[model samples]
Target: MVTEKNNKGNQISRRSFLTGTATAAAGFMIVPRHVLGGKGYTAPSDKLRVAGIGVGGKGESDIAEFAKGPADITVLCDVHDSRAANSVKRFPKAKFYKDYREMLDKEHKNIDAVSVSTPDHSHAIQAMAAMQLGKHVYVQKPLTHDIYEARMLTEAAKKYKVVTQMGNQGASGDGVRQLMEWYNAGLIGDVKEVYCWTNRPVWPQGIPWPTTPAPVPSDLDWDLWLGTAPKKDYVNKLVPFNWRGWWDYGTGALGDMGCHIVEPPFRVLDLGYPESAEASVGSVYVDEFKQGYFPDSCPPSSHCILNFKGKKGKPDVKLHWMDGGIQPARPEELGPNERMGDGGNGAIFIGTKGKMMCGTYGISPTLLPTTRNKEVNVKQTIARVPEGHYVQWVNAAIAGYGKKEVSSPFEIAGPLTETLLMGNLAIRSYDVRKPKANGNGFDYPGRYIKLLWDGPNMKITNFDDANQFVKRTYREGWKLGS
Candidate 1:
């Protein structure tokens, strides 16, 4: 293995040295940037070289944010040229590629970090590739599409010893910290039940796949866009957006918003893997007599209950997750006119003493009765992210591993994402069908079943069929951690 010296003159393996050394040798004598000024100083040219995968939609905004820090946008890759046009115009000098794998193959040496904002299905493989090449990574929310992928990435982050951050920006916000302080001070007096709700699936859901296939767009590389997802024909309006409703490309409303909503309770309560999960989903009626259940698409609404064992002497906690315009009842202590959780998406904690609530991103924290919010005071226990979420990762990458602490490191984000996806497992299981006794129609076997979870083993103890979803089989040519 090739090795390089750090600021402390300690020899470290350079996994990408073969590719990177030639580029550096052609230019100038390559000196580790941290050694330039002093022990802790960063040089003027020591900007983090970044490559972005899926540079469209949220990917576009993520790269733009990274540019605001001490970083250089070195390369851009997107499956669709039209969606990437804005980012390409912004970074006119950056090299462009239609395939992320191709970009990583040739440009791994040129990049110190990678930003992944692709669809949920592709996040794990792309991030794994970057880590294998010894590159720091900043992945967007819902870290992976499946539980096994989340476990693999968490372990890989430690093995590779690289800086990692997940794009659940609220993890760095002050609101969650406030909730933590309040809980620590015994303000809410040990939360027993929690509620998180969102009005998502703002796009189409609870429907069938389009019967008519559309012509692939000239600017889009359909094959590359599919990535690790199973091969399928292109349908109109699936790109740019609306993929959130599909299982193959997306993980539905829970996957889309769970990270933001469930994160607060996870942090404040010190939660771990849920012991068991059960869900009841809303149905769409295709006709007056028949209710629709499409295996390919997510239900229009769902309510999942996840049970977690008590920690630090508190009683067991029950977490309720509701989506599709569903919400919890207003706290009796709250004033009738006062807003409850920003009117749409929010989280509420019910404790023995009182209740507390916050909106999406864990913003606008408040204690029940409205007056208590102003009356209660607690010292700030957690340090705030001064430069905000995007810059936190940028600075950490430049400082090297273990120097600066990031808010949503893979160690924490991975589990939180896994817990959220567990709710998805229950939602999908609720739709499982079998032949009816009378042979007239199908019976929903998974309904009303509380799937016992063996967290350490990553298996469903009660239901065997549900195990198939725990780890998805990638397309023949696409491999994870390749």
Candidate 2:
């Protein structure tokens, strides 16, 4: 979930070096277990030797974090040779594999945990394989490519007694903790709805048209990059980072940024599965370059609404998600330069009493109104939140498996992830035309069916076809857990 803070505050630049472990100055923060770097370890008594799959982009930072403390980098794997090359330089003694399974089998004993930062579609397969080997996992979000895979991984994690964490580092952020604390303090008085928006109009936000085939980068192994995804000609539009807009590769906007932006409220409310999820949006354009890359698939570039029904005895909640298509009208109460909390690429929770706002990546969030409805005396007690999302995971891994609580536990993080993936399903299942009159309009916007999920069976009673898309047969050798 996204946590926003005042933009003017001392925001930690992503490129800046995180000097030390952060301490909580407010009552709502979690006391992070500080890391003593490599000095804390002596004898190897179950000290975690972790492996990393996909060491570029977010995976690069993930590897650095897990390697910081008592944990040793036992294996490094990536489809792109150069991406894996730099990681090898960092840990020269570690085994390296282009195929994740090869590393798992060859270095299984030396590895106690795996950090998975592959594309959305590969998350389940890599994570599940790691668990099958009785290895703990830290998977980036949205947890899995589809719903069935999520259930499969969740069950397998429990079955294997593995400590699991989703890479929604915001789950461990100082602002999210305060968001939950304020809710428990009845500041929002049972949030009825949340609006999450992003200016994330980058490579994945909108549908792009077809393009010419550009030369594949000499450094990347394009065939291995395709992995479980169906074979496609090497086109620039399908390479590097254009897969998110295509069905075969990425999960679009909702799948790409939902975990980061939607987590605050989902975590704080302890919201379980939604009873139903429906969507409304404009048609996506077919790209020339994507002619054979996708199965005639394109992601929407406009607004989409997703309605969710809470579990038994819980308040029904609605999530308004906006992307390339449209966005919520700016709140009129704020000043012109106020920038709707955290550069406007975040979320705001509207509750019965007041409202709260946060940024895309977790930062300390601020309470709106700064008071109760009629209480003029109330005010916000400002404070600083944690600086390092990586150290928290490193410290947990060093403390031994399942010994200390890491942020984004599978119990809460898994389901929260499942709910966001539901939005992805709604997008894939949407019937764009035939307005409300035909009972098929996504224009009702986010109004969706309540699916009766058979978690063990990995099927949805309400939407059989939708459920089928959750699990895809892997390419010959890439079959999961084989």
Candidate 3:
């Protein structure tokens, strides 16, 4: 029974199977699905079995969308019980676990795909583990905590041949395609500068951590939530959302919204690594006379500039990222009362001939002068993702590895995440203060320096200290790929 008959309907001997001559001499062993059920007919067992990690907040929505496709939510994992409460009710049949590690280990064979919606710090390790198990993964935006982790996960997705997508849902939106189409048609005339801004860090930033530690919530697993982050006492109001302002747990404004706002320009410009990066961060005034840096937290505001070498025959491009309510001045072409960049989070491209802008998720794309939007007609060259981002991954996972294309696969999202994190590197470097030689005060060593970057090497050639942020040393027992 181990050996089956081949295409000519001839029975294949064990010798033929061992010699790998089944295709040549005896023909194929496994029957094609079309032969059994006709074309395009999927069996019940063909439904992709999916697991959701950190199934709360955005995770809740992500899993629900996947459930709409040919997918079955088989498991859910979260560090906090309350966060998982709603998702558990939504998927009554799905098993729930507190630790993703245990769930993956126990149900590896049963699970076909994983959706990682954890915080920035834990994203890499969780996604890598699933990919290593040959499970397709859909990770949340800003794919990883550090540049090295992003690079590693990008390579792992390819090596494992698993379908992968980042939760930058905007990547799948039609707006970006329109932007690309317009750019290709030379409507923007070789963009030389891009401005992306967001009013984020809506949580606390540029402030000290609570001096008094608060007791961990009864329903939350503090240790598991910390994951690879350095051990620290629990602080009230830090969990769930406030962690976005902390360097150890989150990546500030850039990580929170850059992936969505900056993605269009990155795609349209075909930008890779930045040649150099520099930044200026706004400081918090503790009092009328005192200003503080609060190195542990992200600054209240920042303006980072990254220079990218030109592609093809275009000129070099300079990208400006502003966050924490800072925004670029209105372009002259826009009407006086008209809004810029959705009034809060948006992206604007400045080219030799014209300008174009869009809001978050690359939605609401418009050209300068407003009237050009209606007048300029461009053919859509890029294909749109059907049913949008979540379903895009759902269908791709069911299609198996390399069978379907995903919009933000790790290969593309990784470098994009790295590009955004580079702005953070510059921001963090801006806070690097050292004792002065005169001993009178401290000097900010990292300020005003244009840090040269070597993308392939993932290092700052001019600043050795800045390289430390490129990859962090995990807490002893917690390693990426463990």
Candidate 2 residue-wise lDDT, 31-130, digit = tens:
2323322222212234567889998777878888776666788788998876667788888987878888778878876777889998887888899888
Task: Kindly report which residue pairs in candidate 3 clash with one another.
Answer: none
The reply for model 2, stretches above 4 Å from the true place, is 1-47, 204-215, 284-302, 310-314, 370-388, 430-464
lDDT to native, each model: 0.84, 0.65, 0.83
- RMSD list, candidates in order: 7.8, 8.9, 9.4
Q: Which stretches of candidate 3 lie over 4 Å from their true place?
A: 1-45, 430-443
Per candidate, the number of residue pairs that clash is 0, 24, 0
lDDT of 3 by residue, 299-361 (tens): 899999999998657899999999989999899999998988788899999999899999999
By TM-score: ranked, best first: 1, 3, 2
Tens-digit per-residue lDDT, 1-482, candidate 1: 11112222322121101111222235565466545633223333589889999888899999999999999999999989999999999999999998888899999767888999999999999999999888899999899999999999999988887889999999888888778777777788879999999999798888878889999999998898898888999999998788889989898899999899899988788788999999998888877767777777888999999999986477999999999998999889888889999888999999999899999989999989789977887766456777888998897777666666677888889889889888888888733456444433334555579989999899998887778789999988999986
lDDT, residue 71, model 3: 88
- The lDDT of model 3 is 0.83
Candidate 1: where is the Cα deviation over 4 Å? 1-45, 430-443
Model 3: lDDT of residue 360: 97
